[model samples]
Target: MTSKTIASSEPSIIESIDQLFLRFIVGKNKIYKEEEYNDGLSEAEQDDKELGLPAAEEKSGWNQRILLEVEKDRVKRVEADKRLKDKRNALLMRYFQQSLLKVVNDKLENSESVISDQLQLRENTVELLKKLLAGEPRYSVLASLLELNPGTRNRLLSLVSSEDFMKALGRDPRNVRDIQTAIGMIGTDVLRFLVPAILFKYRINAYSHHNTLFAKKLWRYEMTLGQTCTALMHDINYRRPYEGMLLSAMVNFAYVASYQQYLSSFEVVRTACLDQAREKGEKNRHDFFYDIKTDSASLQALLVSQADLKLSLALSEKLFQKSFPHLVNALKEEVEGLAYEERTTVGKILFKAVRFAKYDQLRSSRLFKPEWQDDYLADSYIEQDVFKNLLRQELFRFKPTWS
Candidate 1:
């Protein structure tokens, strides 16, 4: 008789998420220098040069920085064609504007700082925002980019730094060089936990229908999905992820916007569900929809919704093409090169990843009340037992944000 063959199973979903989180956890990505450095200049100088900025002429105790101010004096008057077409996105943007307004107003003025609508950002943080918008300092993408290990601060300063990463956002590396030679300029409060929270008031006015400022966190969450989809796309097609990444960010954002009002409406359900689920076993619980993220049907329907995607694509082009021309064009070229089926598959993967991220976030916050239902496991793409186990594994991971 021929020897029987048995295939070993893959990691569960819980395991995969755990694996991914650990893979991307802060400081896990270490910079590996392929060549030895012999330049007499210190590591700090080396880093500055790597970012395409001029190193200090002489070692001064204080680093000379070219401060770039955020343009608040003039109204950002984008033309009608140049306007963000997504009314929801426009609404969310108003959230950013109001949030900004709270910190900056014409009535109150000061030389040392800029505060509007009672929101006070450190003078340095405002500078950091300028660098981020200008794509300068390279590390601006990762916020403060605080590194645990000085010896090896991720692949480049931190996981999200480096010109290549930001280039994926359609920005020019050249623009970064002219802004400021000095790097690591901001290193205090905002870096630790401010920028996102700093702009927000603890007691927000309930006036606007789109008052909730959860969109920032949603951006962070969707970016993770877009990025992970980029990785998965590369795994399938073996092409660089620039196109997939940019396109995915736009798609993910639109889908997230679809849930804009839902995000707020879910709170009442969440509170009720939490109370109902208390002291009850899974088998004994009543059925209830606890999340405003809506059903999978809406997600699947989004893929076929041309109107939804077109508005988003148009807005994305209008909003970013000026600043990130290269990144946007890269996606166009890549979409042409890739097969339609492949791009669709990438979109599907992104949808799946965002659902996973949302599930994990909700579960972490104790709002994922229907714990008994593992609907994602039933998706046709992950039908195999190996994939099923992978889904199971994701639940074991710890929550880093939104907890």
Candidate 2:
């Protein structure tokens, strides 16, 4: 047969079986040779050789490579975690910003509707004061001086004639100059009495266009504070309810000043609260929005530096020194010597009164506790029999006409 023809032909079964046996023997011999070579080493080295582990010298290199891979994975995971946390924080910030913007816009939209109501309440308060003071001859004279309405002036004049007015003034006027002097003296006293009310009225007008609800609420709060302070002062035999009134009225003067500058005061307060929260850590996080202690401290500072009340100058200075030592050096030149106990007593009562008013407002509005708890006036101090009785009486008598 030709060679091509012979190759094309199939092999016999015996020939194929022989070829398969030859391939199997060759593979088995190679494995036997490796086993025979491993037999020369000790049991541990044989196991190591079987497992294909590196020698000690090369072990470090292998470990380093493994560590490099692990480190790489750790870094990737850490970066991913950081990205996730940043995304979460950004979303939270956006939500808070939207919420704040909505609140601001709502306040603006509803301002006009509420302004007339606030004005009506203010007018009602003024009328109530007029009625309360009508019986006093001095007040009648003061009313005549301040009254712009012709009919009201005539009515007040009729109630107090020139003779009665002069007697009340404790002056026997012989000439126009004497009469003018008597009128001026009475006017000064009237102005002193009217200062709180005047401030209240001015704030109502000034803030109506800016934040009507806040203006009304602030006026109410001041009134409540003034009344409470007056009662507390009388109970403690402080003998100066008017001074208490002035002090309480001036508590939010800084806020008013801030309003004048387009709510810069709120920003200052907000920043201060945030700074305090960061310093105090998570436990005091709520303080970032409404810290009562900070409010009291700021108010005390303003009273010392800006309230301009001679009677309170010494007391305010002492309060500032005790409550805010950091400010002492800057204010030392302005501080006057005063009794520490007296200043402390005044500060406690003032702080409690403001806190109570804030709390009462929150409660009346049916607001949540956390929203106002930072400004909470602890009942621990104000719940005593003396304070409790006085607050109860004042609250009962308190009539917020504008609500």
Best by TM-score: 2
How far residue 106's Cα lies from its native spot in candidate 2, in Å, is 27
Among these predicted structures, which one has the highest lDDT? 2
Off by over 4 Å in 2: 1-194, 204-207, 263-343, 368-380, 394-403
**lDDT tens readout by residue for model 2, 15-101:** 332222222211212222222433124545665555444467775753544547886677577657756755764454454344443
Candidate 2 scores a C-alpha RMSD against the true structure in Å of 35.2
